[model samples]
Target: MFVPCHQKLVSAFLLLYCLHLSAFDFLWPCPQKCICRQDTLEVNCSSKHLTVVPEGLHISARRLNLSGNRLKTLIRRQFYGLTQLEELDLSGNIISMIEVEAFQGLKYLRILKIKNNRLKIIPVGVFSGLSSLLSLDISKNEILVFLDYTFQEMVNLRELNAGENDLVFISQRAFVGLQSLQELNVDHSNLTSIPTDAFSQLQSLSKLRLRRLNINVLPNYAFRRLHQLRTLQILQWPSLETLNSNSLVNLNITSLVISNCNLSAIPYASLRHLTHLIYLDLSYNPITSIESNKLGELLRLQEFHLVGGKLLRIEPGAFRCLAHFKLLNVSSNRLTTLEESAFHAVGNLQILRLDRNPLTCDCRLLWVMRRRFRLNFDGRQPTCSAHERGRRREFRDFSEAEFSKVFICRQAGILERKLQDVMVDEGTNVQFECKVDGYPQPSITWLSPQQTPFSSVGRIRVHANGTLEVRYAQVQDTGTYLCIASNAAGNDNISASLHVRSSSRNYTPPNFFDESLVETSLPPSTNSSAQLSSPFPFDAKTIVIATTMGFLSFLSSVVICFVFMFLWSQSKGQIKHTATIDFVPRSSMGGGGEGGDTGRFTMKLI
Candidate 1:
């Protein structure tokens, strides 16, 4: 095996490197109770009931989790040798104090979480060495106040959460040097008032949440320095009642929510400067009225919520200049009447919620009722609140009768009527009556078959009972006749057909028979021969014709009775007839009657 000299030297160097790596792996020391993974440079000493940081931790560890422990204090130089530590989690511990130089040597630390601890105050210079810290969470602590320059050294801090604390005040310059800070959440704290300069140095902050505080009034220029703020939420401020005009006069926030503030009215002047505002929520207030143009300055506003307000009325043009507005929620109010012009300016509204209001459902609110299908809102239908009767009924449940009663100031309209056809001989007179039921007793007018006014026609006459009588119903009158009934409200019409027949002399009147003949009549031999003599010139066939005609008349009488009963049933007993009608068959008209037997029909009045 003759190898080159350079190959031999390389082989020796490889063996030495392997030995050095093994020695380094075996020499790294781990704390007795903690588990260390040298490959990942991570350590977990959680839930060990450890009172202090164990010594001799691996210097290569980057993440050290010491949560769920009994550690009471974080002493100075606790992590002296672990300069490469990036994350330190001391959450769920009883840590109350953090001494100076506690994080003295870790310069590259990026995240530090001390949540759910008993920390009362954050002393100055406690995080002096951690210049690369980006996120710090001290939530669920007993922190009372934020002293001046408390976070002036963390220049690269981006997110800071100090929520669920007992913080009462924040001194000016508390966040002086946090140049890269983006989100600051101090919600669920006891903050009474925020000094004007508390957020003066937060030039890059965009989102600020200060909910559930004791802030009573927002003074002038409270948040004027936050130029980059886009979202501001100050919710659940129990004592907050008033806001000055200059409080938020300079910010360019897009979303603002000031709910549950016990406000009586909208601070329109304070919000007049937010031209770029889009979403505004003033819910849970006691606002009674909405004057016109109250929120007209928010041109770009899209959604406006005023839920649970005691709004009684909204002046016309109140929601005027919102060009891109879409949603409006004014539910749970005390509105009695909403004029049609109230929503005349909101052109692009897509959603509207007006439930739980004592709205008076009348003619003025008909416009909203017409658009009920487009505005799909939840809850029961709105009811009328004008008088006692109006209160018992919902607007959607109105019937024709109910509407007539409520809107009685209008004119009359025909409700019920009948138009029956009449038949008469050409020389006889016939009448047609249009009996109608209306409120104001409408006037009646008739038009002849030629469309000429009945009053102008010589043969036609109108009666006081709305009946039109034609003295002689000639063949020309055998067409449709129109009857018009009119009043102030409106007009209605009905038409009747007149069927005229040629005059027939064979239709003779029946003579009275003797009572003795009807009770006990003898055969036609001697006693009745004189009474049965023919009056017209006829042969023996007249007897057969008369007997047949008598039989037919009997059948016709039965048919007429059936027809009369049917008409009575169909009319429901509301018939108002001045005369009765009788139908006679063609055979009853003797031979050589006028106008040959048409074999169709001839009407008669009895």
Candidate 2:
């Protein structure tokens, strides 16, 4: 049994040695100055004080780490045997010139990282033989620009990272045959401008990170045929104070981040045409204001984050058309107030973030604070600095429970409001009183059903007696209308509905008691077949009814006729139109623009 076990152990040793030889071909009789370790599948011939790589590298080796070496140039005969190599690391080397056909036989090479090299210009067709290259990291090199076809035939290349290089001008069609490219990072390069039609054929490019390039202007149609681009980060251009509107006309992107630059204002009108954007980040800019209804055209936008921009004030209704949003972050600004109806389209909002901003504790902030739910904040120093008695103090120190403590100082009381549940027909005048409890007389403003605020006018008037009156109310005004009553102390708001009563659209004169009768009824003794001939009869039983109906009709006719005659007579006469003008004295109107207290009045009608 011992002899048989010895034989089995010998057989196992032989099988393992053959497997090791197949993995590292440079073993036993290793290459001149290279030491191939079969156990680790690693060749550490790097920085061996050699000027050139000896021949006969492992054909089955998967990786060769040649960093920290003194190889100034590459010849084809050195790497002519590495057929199964997938990863080649030549980092921290002095590779100055890469001869043509240097990598001719490495068809299955996937990764090539040549950081901290000394190549000034890469020749064409240098990497054309790497058909299976996936990722290439050539950072920290002195490459200024490469030939147009330096990386021509890399069909399966996915990511190319050439950041931290000295690239000033790139040749058009530099990255032509890289069809499988996904990510390209060339940030902090010295590129000034991208030539038009530079990226005309990269149909599969996904992410292009060219942030912090010395790019002053991106020429029109610079990114023309990049239809499948998903993410674009163009930021940190301090000299870029403005963008010509035609720079990015039609880009099919999902996330567009432009921040940390010196842009005074984003031309929202230019971006109103991008119909496929979903996430937009325009923070860290110097934009001061956005016009109302800006960003109203981005129909599919869901996440809008604009923070760290030195914005003084956003005009009310600035984010007019950005509805159906999921997350909106507008914090870290210099804003003092948020009007009560700040979040206009808050019906579908889920997350509203407002942190690290100088929010004045006033009635204006009460509107947004009353609705902020699950608001995320900085927990370490999460305190809202507010002005209090004689000085500024920290209030609401980032606690969920404390945020519920509304800090209203000397505001109005809970002014009671109620609505009458009475039904009225259409075209009838309706009136209601707006009552409130305050030290100052309450001034009221009404808003129509369609979210339009009302003004005191001829048709819809508000009397000094605090009564809201509307004449000839139409069916379109059949919805809940808001009434906001406010004075110096605070404000109180409520809504009232005016419903028009029309015969229900479904109301059919059901089969009358006599279905065969052509007319409704007649003032007779159970007569079903006889039609109401003249709608009235001067009979004994119907005399009183006929006389009453005649009186009402005559009265209505007299009122209509009187109104028409009065209007006609007034039209025919020399009607003198009165104009009320109380001109302010020159001395009294010295400083004020409108109010001079000289019984000031002016009238003009359209």
Candidate 3:
């Protein structure tokens, strides 16, 4: 304690020097070309073009990024000093070989990324001691196979991304100890089929993506053991054709997407088991139709999407009983008409996307026109087909009154007058013409005198233009024939009598314009009283006059009924009647359907 003053000063200087060396130890020996942030404890040696792992790394470095380097192989104890490192990225390297225990002392490493490398095989014990690793990304590599117990030591790994690899085979126990893994991605692999045995080990997997695999069929119970899986996406599988009905048998997923595949129809049977499914996307497949009762079992389904396919028609009741269904997108298909009954069973549909389709503007779309303002079209309103009067016009551009007028659905009516009686000799050919018109082009049906329907077979034939042709008229064909034209609106009919005489009798064809010759041309055996008692005594002019009067009467009756309904609707205050044609603005309505107005307009009769 009684030292000299000069000696005390020298001792104090030595002590200060030792403290400075210990405090700046991690900063002085930093790698030559690497940037070391002492405050954050991060060392970045990326893109340095070094052929080996750099020396002089700090012992307490928490994150080390050595990506985009030229390191060829990872020898044992390559990172033996960085015991506290939490994240290590060795991506974009040429590391093809790794010795056992290469990562021996990284006890607290949580994330390891070694992607985009040229590693062809991973020997056992490559990841032996990384028990605390939470994520491992080995994608974009040339790994050919996954041997058994490859990742058996990473017990706490929760995510594994092995996509974009040349993987063709996976051992049954490749992922034996990864019980806590929740997400796995193996997309763009060369696997020939679903590795069911390998996948069955991941009992805790919640999301899986298997895209662009060289596989054809998804066998039954492929994912039966993935009970905790909630989302499954199988995309860009060009060779995938058949999805067995029991493929998703025991799954409880909420979202399933199978896009860009070779599916020719909806896999209804395969999807029937996912009763809790909420969203389904089957876009860009060759599906042609949505059959009835196939999707009715998915009562909890909310969104159904089938865009960009060869969908020509959706059968009636296709979306039946889906009470919670909200959105349906079938845009860019070959659909001509969407029937009103298709959405009759849906309880609360809000959006319907039918754009880029060849939609015919007709009565089948009347229901859509009425609810154009109420329903959301996803900002891409549907346009009419080129054949309609309002070609390429958006549904939102037309007012309700204008739409009703342009897209009229009239009852079927025969254009020609009553057919004249025909007196032909036996073995002669006869024909009767029936021209009709309607909005939907009613179907033509021919009925023989015996009340039996005549088809385009045997001696009787019905032509495409609504013509009834008799090849060889016989005596049995000497009765009244009827032609009926019918559609959803209504039906119309016309009748004509045919008199076929025996070939032996001398007969002269009567002129239709000369009434006297028509009356006298009857066969002698046929009684005059019976001929005069014919109910069709009207001439051509008279028949024309009667048809015109009947049409006028029908028009008046329709007007009267419409006026009565309009008055009644106004009295009940359920619908808003307008004296002039005007668009129903969306802002005027309350909650789409809560107000008295149902977003429809009525034209008051003058």
Candidate 4:
């Protein structure tokens, strides 16, 4: 406890020096439960459970955050002395009323966020002195209508977000003075139609989002005045059904998204004028097919997405002349097959997303299989449906050597063993069966000896079962008929000869008359060479060979049937029954399937 006088004096001097330096640091007062950074002139008073704005804020504060608080009202000249304030955040508050002159002195403020508030109506002069504001967010509010000249004072405003509000009516002059506005968002509103008159004033707007509106149709020239718009998104309009032919006539947009709508088909006519479009997304629509030549006008389109739709087929030449196309995502669709011709014009495709589709593994998809490694699947590889082997498998599971085996295709083959030549009397009904089979199910067409194509019309008709029926056989119908079956794999043809004899002549059937019987039935004067030609021209040796082959085929069929029955009976006898009980978790029970059963007794034979 005893100290020398020299040591005590030195300690006292050091203590006073430290106190002097701390005095200058405490010149600016920071309110309780608030953080004030003097170096950056920023103050954060967020989520402090404060009832009123803190007093004695730093004069040089350039940024202030009062979000997530209980502040209900902003009085006149609330922040009068904070002249250097550039950014102010008052979001996530219970602010329902703001005086007209509350922000009258914030001339330097550039960004103001008052979103997620209970503001019912924004009076005309509420934002009177925020002339230098560049961005304003009033989203997630209960604001009803935007009266005329409501935002006229924000002349230099560049971006405005008024989404997720109860906005129903907007005056024509609501956006009269926002000349420098570049982006606007009015999503999730109750408006029934596009506010064309109000949008015409935003000539400088480049990006616009109008999602989740109650509109049902997009009328012609809906966005004609938005000449400078480069990106437009109209998503989640469930009632939207029709897009008029001239809806997008004057738009020069490069990116467009119209997803999650009730669009039954692509609005090809409406998109015909968007020649400058580069990215297009029509995802989550009920579009069943993409017809040929409909989207060819979009030559500059590079990325296209039609995900989660009812798309069944992409016809040949559907994407013709899209040389600049790169990315295509048609995932989560009901597509059975995608032919090579569908992407013949899209040679430059780099990223393909064909996953989540029931694609049939066939020759039509051979082109995709060959380039599987070179193309980017975007993390979701394509999967083949159960059409081939009753199980789904990803395309990457197959190797180059399995290409021909997995993606198999057969050329059309006639089911009949041989084409039957027929001789029918005139006026009798004549029919020719040309049943054929092939991968992708070939289409049948008939051609007469005169080179005339026959269809399901007039006296000659091609039935749905691939049978060509001629109601009344005439002399013109006599001759060889060609039945052609064609598909993507290949084409096959079979010919049948038909002879129609006149009804005036009486003749014995060739098959019924034996060689000896024909000679006796004919007159003695008629020469043997002149007798009707025998329909059956088989010799004794030929008859024996045919009979032996028929017997062998029948015997082989019987043996195979017996073997199948023996195996089935043996397997059935070996099965043993075991009583098992399974208890499914509540999480699994929510699925409402057999596997999700709460409690089940599985009786398996052991």
Candidate 5:
């Protein structure tokens, strides 16, 4: 191939220009002020004093965070070439408007968050080519109303959050094409009434939250077409006064919450078709009473919360039909009594809250008090004045003697106790105590491993306070000791092992029982009124035992030392030690408790 000299020069210059451009793009994929993560393909331009979207970004970038900037408007092709972007966060920007086809080629985007921006109107076709979009959060913006096809291009969208916007009226077809949407949040808005066909296209919607809206009434059959809906929450709607009959008919929801509404009674007819409902929360309402069979058709209901209502009474069989009911909260109410049959058929009840009610003390709550020991009804049981005594006291604190006239009560069984293992050296003492609390004043007795009664011997004693003490312990005292507390209700026992080890090298103790001691050496009387003025107030028997144990321990130590010295003396000179010095203090001789003495202590070793 032959080429002219001038043509070759032109081709070489063009190749050099292309190479320089490639080098520039490789060295700085993002703006100097922004931070780029090459490994994760993420670009963070947040708070970078940027006024416009950076022109060039890594082609493989997946997440782009452009929040906290002064970008005012998003023109067409602002994000021209980033095709692999899956998450784009443009929140906390001053973007007031967006041109149509602004995000033209972001076909793989799944999550787009433009919240906390100044966007007032979503121009049609703004998000045109976001085919794989799943979640779009445009909350906390100045958007007033939804125009037709505003979000029509995002067909794959699943979650839409338009909360905290001034959405006054939603056109009938505003959210028409969002067939895959499952959750819709329009809370904290100024929506007065929801059109009957507002949600006509949302067949797959499962969760709908309409909190802090000023809507007046929920129209009839408002949610009849949403067969897959599982949750509907309308919270903090102070203006929600009337709910028409059959408004919520033919629904299969599992949970429904209508909190802080001003309804005086439950709209039972409206909820008759929710047969599959499991949780219903009507908290902060003014519902006065709960009638029998009002919600009987909801057989699978598990938790029903009527907290902070003005409930006066719960009629018989109020919760009889809920076979699988687990929790019932009626706290902060004005109920006086619960009919005996209110919870007749609710066998699966696990938690029942009835605190903060102005209940009157009477025999109506006798069953509740008895069942308290079985159920986990640990919420505050009300305090009321005793009918006979006219004094206020807690429900559990009322004694069986006080309530004997009301009903025949049985004794309480053993609930809980603690027994610890005893470990000590031989010749040292050990004390084992057992505490028991039950009705009819349980009788406590200690026994050995052979199930025989513990004998009160010279080195063993059972105090009246349920304490067993063993003095001058031996290796034979290592065995299981059982404490049996018996009453009319039942008998419960706990056993603990005592381990007594020898004070010698490589000496592991064996577990044994010592029942050979005589049964005549009982302890002294335990008077309750004895007071001492000094710190070291030791009794005569305790002092004698302590001194004898101490002297024996010292003598054993000295004998061991003498044996070692005698062994060493065989290899060297004999080592002998002697000491003799004695001087009696004048105070000990009863000389006005003062002493001035001098003595010379002598020691001789050979």
Candidate 6:
């Protein structure tokens, strides 16, 4: 074993020479102008107008980027010593066709992104021995159809982006062994809705962007096993027109952004039952009106942005139960009025933006506007009529500055709205007058408790706002009455009451009474005994005058007693009524308004 060092070297040299001769004998001749790089042992003579694979490589380079070169065909057994090759990206070359088993010995390849290349179809078994492959991206190519198991031996493949390819139909079990696949992005491509359970085996998967596709109706339980997913963003889908409450049947997703749909409406119960939702985006839709009771059920909602939807009206008790809400944006709409008491329960309003709408302003908002204005430096005072005479208009104009002025300034120069007057009487004509302000005169309409607009009755007449008169009121108008004066900012309403008072006996005689009939029963003896004769002496003509005076006094006494008795009865009836209510509820519309006293809301809601 201990031979001379020179002898051992000579023997090793001969052995290496024989092996080199044997390898060179079978290998093809190296192409001209091709340089075998010493470090990687790869022949990189591409893009020099060569027609065949460069042979006689150094056989060490395992990876190659021979893209951006011209080579038409991959000859059989064209790469014999490239067994150590792991990954390849032959995308930009002019290579058009390849025979099967083109990569028979590239066993260690892991990832490939051969998208955006010009190939008509991928040959079968093109990647058969690539057992260690983990990912592949063959999207954005002109390949029309795929042979079964185009990725048959890529057992370890976990991700694929085969989107944007021309392959229409993928044979079933085409990617069966890809059990380790976790993420796939086949979006923005040709396939429509997925057949039922097409992704059932991808339990380890989490996210997929299947929106903006060709399908109109989403098949039921389409996402049956995707429970691990947390977010699904269905954005700008052109053909998607409808979505039932059960569309998200199998999803426990935390967030959903279903914006820009073709929905006519949304049920309040539909949104309220998604109890686990913390954020939801429903903007740019065609929902016309929201159910008054719908928004109240979503107590956990934090933000609601309806940027470009067309909302016409909100019901009286619409948002009565949105307790912890923070932001509500109802911009770019056609709303003209707001009720003063609608926000009575919304005490925690921090930012309420109602900009760029035609709002009518008037004094009827003295209460609500004044209170809202006092909230902060930025208060919104609904615009009101400025000039008292000559075609009184609502708010002259609406601007951000005007809205800010209403906020900073506690009161507008003119009370844009009038106080509402509640009447409790039959046929009690209530006139709700308000001085609205705007470019043109604001139109005034009576808004009933039922939220219906009523034109003025002959009994009720509205002047600019100097005064409102309720004539011959009965007990029927006992309910609340609001004088809604509107222009652009919003409508202002004032509430007052018409009380039907029970009739009382007032037998007040004429102011000028004669001083003649004065015959006192106890003072007659005292006045005659001393310096005066009989105060009402009973002599002949004197006796006649005295008797007449006495008779008159007796008659006057009886009349006073009767008047007192009648008054006592009226007072009793009044006491009984006061015990019930200021305005009688049983009173019908405009029933018992027999004019007594009118009350005003001096202090605003603030």
Candidate 2: what lDDT? 0.71
Candidate 6 structure quality by residue, lDDT tens digits, 143-231 = 76555567667777777776666555555556556666666656455556563344565555555655445655555566676666556
Which window of ten consecutive residues has the lowest lDDT sum in model 3?
589-598
**Measured by C-alpha RMSD in angstroms, how accurate is candidate 3?**
33.7
- For each candidate in the order shown, give its overall lDDT on alpha carbons: 0.80, 0.71, 0.88, 0.88, 0.80, 0.56
Counted clashes in each candidate structure? 0, 0, 0, 4, 1, 73
Q: What does candidate 2's lDDT look like per residue over 343-376, in tens digits?
A: 4476666665566766555445554455554443
lDDT of 3 by residue, 425-512 (tens): 8878899999999877788998999899888877789988989998778788899999999865789999988998887565434333
Candidate 2 Cα errors over 4 Å, as ranges: 1-41, 44-50, 54-56, 338-344, 350-352, 367-373, 378-382, 389-406, 409-606
User: In candidate 2, which residue pairs clash?
Assistant: none
Better of 1 and 3 by lDDT: 3
lDDT of prediction 6: 0.56
In angstroms, the error of model 4 at 577 is: 99
Clashing pairs in 1: none
Global Cα RMSD, each model: 33.1, 28.1, 33.7, 26.7, 28.7, 31.3
Per-residue lDDT for 1-606 in model 4, tens only? 999999999999999988965763576578888888877888999999877889988778999999999999998889988999999999999999988878988999999999999999998888989999999999999999999999998999999999999999888999999999999999899999888889988999999999899999999888768899999999999999999999888999999999999999999999999999999999999999999878888999999999999999898988888889899899999998888787645469899999988888888888888888898999998998845652488888888787777788888888885856999987778889999999878889999898788878878889988888877677678999899998888999899889988774653333434566444643347455644565667656789999999999999999999999989988877654587777765763455555654767778764
Which window of ten consecutive residues has the lowest lDDT sum in model 1? Answer: 506-515
Residue 141 lDDT (model 1): 97
Cα TM-score of candidate 3: 0.68
TM-score of candidate 4 to 2 decimals: 0.72
Give the lDDT of residue 196 in candidate 4: 88
Per-residue lDDT tens digits of candidate 5, residues 1-606? 999999999999999989977875686487777888776788899988788898778878899999998989998978878888999999999899899999998989999999999887787788889878999999999888888777777788999999999888787878777989999999898888875577867889999988898877888888768888899999999988788888888778999999998888888888888899999999999999888888888988999999998998788788877788888889889986665578745456777787787755555666666666555665666655434452466667776676656422234333445657888888777888777776435668889767778756656777776778887778888999888877544677877789988776543333345546535355566754563444567877889999999999999999999999878888797545887777655565567433467556777865
> Judged by lDDT against the true structure, how good is candidate 1?
0.80
How does candidate 5 score on lDDT? 0.80
- The estimated TM-scores of all candidates read 0.56, 0.60, 0.68, 0.72, 0.60, 0.47
Model 5 ranges off by over 4 Å: 1-28, 378-606
Descending-TM-score candidate ranking: 4, 3, 5, 2, 1, 6
